[model samples]
Target: MIPSYLKDIGKEIHSNKESTKLKIICTCGCDEFKLFRKKKSREYIKLEKEYEEQFIKEFGRGFEMQSDLNGQVFVIKRNIFGKIVKKTEIKKLDIPLFKNFISVKCSSCCREYILFDENIHGYDAVIEKNQESTIVESKHYSDDSQKIEVIVYYNDDNEEENINDLSVAFGRIKIIKITNNKKITYCDFECE
Candidate 1:
């Protein structure tokens, strides 16, 4: 979930003419929406640092925790006290990476739309703009050379005046790369 203040800003953006062209219409036929950039708060960043410090203090320098895009955190533990450090255990932690998303809320029915999320390793995003449209593309690549792309199309003038607005509206955007064998594509559009 994003901060309420950001949602308030979204409501303000929703009132803009350019925003009307960029909003995703709700199933209820409402085109007005509150847009929010999902980002990590300062407190969250500080806590994350503290957690990393504590994790290193408890498990030593070589041990580390891994987090997936779905917000699952896990650590591998070995039986260090035993004579043989062969047995290992996998433990899940409650910490979640809640950042890196774009959320939109319908002004009428209050429905929420979460976009551009992936649960794979090596995730990236790219934003491309021509005179007529802006395309936000997200890519996920696997070690096996498989890549999946999700592209969101925004039809607008892409002018300087609306650049800041669009940046704030879309939050953190990312990019993609083509792999050896397989490619998959998915698209979503928001236009007047």
Candidate 2:
């Protein structure tokens, strides 16, 4: 069950017009979802302070810096001279990203989904009945601003499938050839 405070925050996130434009439906055919957004609220600030205090209590020293990398938390213990004394990697911290993003879970199926990510150029998901799978595709921009497409396959049961089972190849444009005066386009991608 979601807490009432979190539900209030979800309502605040849903009030954004741009966020509402992106629709993500669950495989169970339910469009309702619980939204969560990272924002700077009084509660958020309190949570951060509490975490820092807890870290100091456990480590017996105040951490100079804290970071979350690849779902792992790391705290840097610095000496009074501002030199790094020790760097310790700890368990995952529940701190959210400072950037703009919207996370959601299906109300009916409880399937987790990302509605929007600031780093991603585009995000979408759709169910392919013929293939008996749900196709999720996200577009990302490289350092040079080149568009890259990332695709994830999920079965009808809402479980993620292995990437090796994918039948279609991605990250390439369709090749067109003329055979006997007939145009033939190879490498057709349904989720363009």
Candidate 3:
């Protein structure tokens, strides 16, 4: 008869599988949401590369998307030799039913909106701080499968400024932008 310890080990293995539940991977045209597979770990990178290759072999090419900052819906086009073959717009609302998305908060007002999910996990900026003026342009993803940008202006007359993600209610961002335009513009994500 199998020993009790061996039986316990088997049970543990079974439970481990159950605990690490594998959901149906989200996709559009075979390889949507591929970036989600990437993590800041070597192991994850290797595994993702393997998965990507396997997917390419099985499902063919993936979509190349282009969208504006804070705009929902992405344009997917398949190009050969840099010529557009076919193009279509995929809206965030069009994400398949199986996957889940979270609602994001406005970075400025800290108010909430039920319009979309928080697929964009981080913010980035393009900033230029010179003796004349300080201009910043922050970018982020939206639940609408769109990349959005925001502009922040600071007074160069001040000794210095620290408008980091940690300093503002926006928290941490994945990207930021800085522009030299004197006329300041606001982030479109800000609610009225």
Model 3, 1-192: lDDT tens digits are: 111211211112111211211111112211011111111347656766776686466435765666668764554545567775655565444222111122223333333222111232112121222122111133233432222222212222222435332112222212112234232221223210
Ranking by TM-score: 1, 2, 3
True-structure RMSD, every candidate: 18.6, 18.7, 24.3
Query: Candidate 2's residue-wise lDDT over 30-73, tens digit each?
Result: 65555444455698889888987887775666445476655666
lDDT, candidate 1, 1-192, per-residue tens = 121223322222123332221223466766544444444669888888898898776676787555668766656556756333332344655677442444455666766655333221111211322222212253222223222222222334434333423432332223222345443322332221
Candidate 1: where are CA atoms >4 Å away? 1-23, 47-98, 118-192
Candidate 3 achieves a global lDDT of: 0.28
Model 1 steric clash total: 5
Select the stronger candidate by lDDT from 1 and 3.
1
User: By lDDT, highest first, what's the ranking?
Assistant: 1, 2, 3
- Per-prediction TM-score, please? 0.27, 0.25, 0.20
Regions of candidate 2 where Cα sits further than 4 Å from its true position: 1-22, 41-97, 122-192
Per-candidate Cα lDDT values, in order, are 0.40, 0.39, 0.28
| Model 2 residue 99 lDDT score | 36
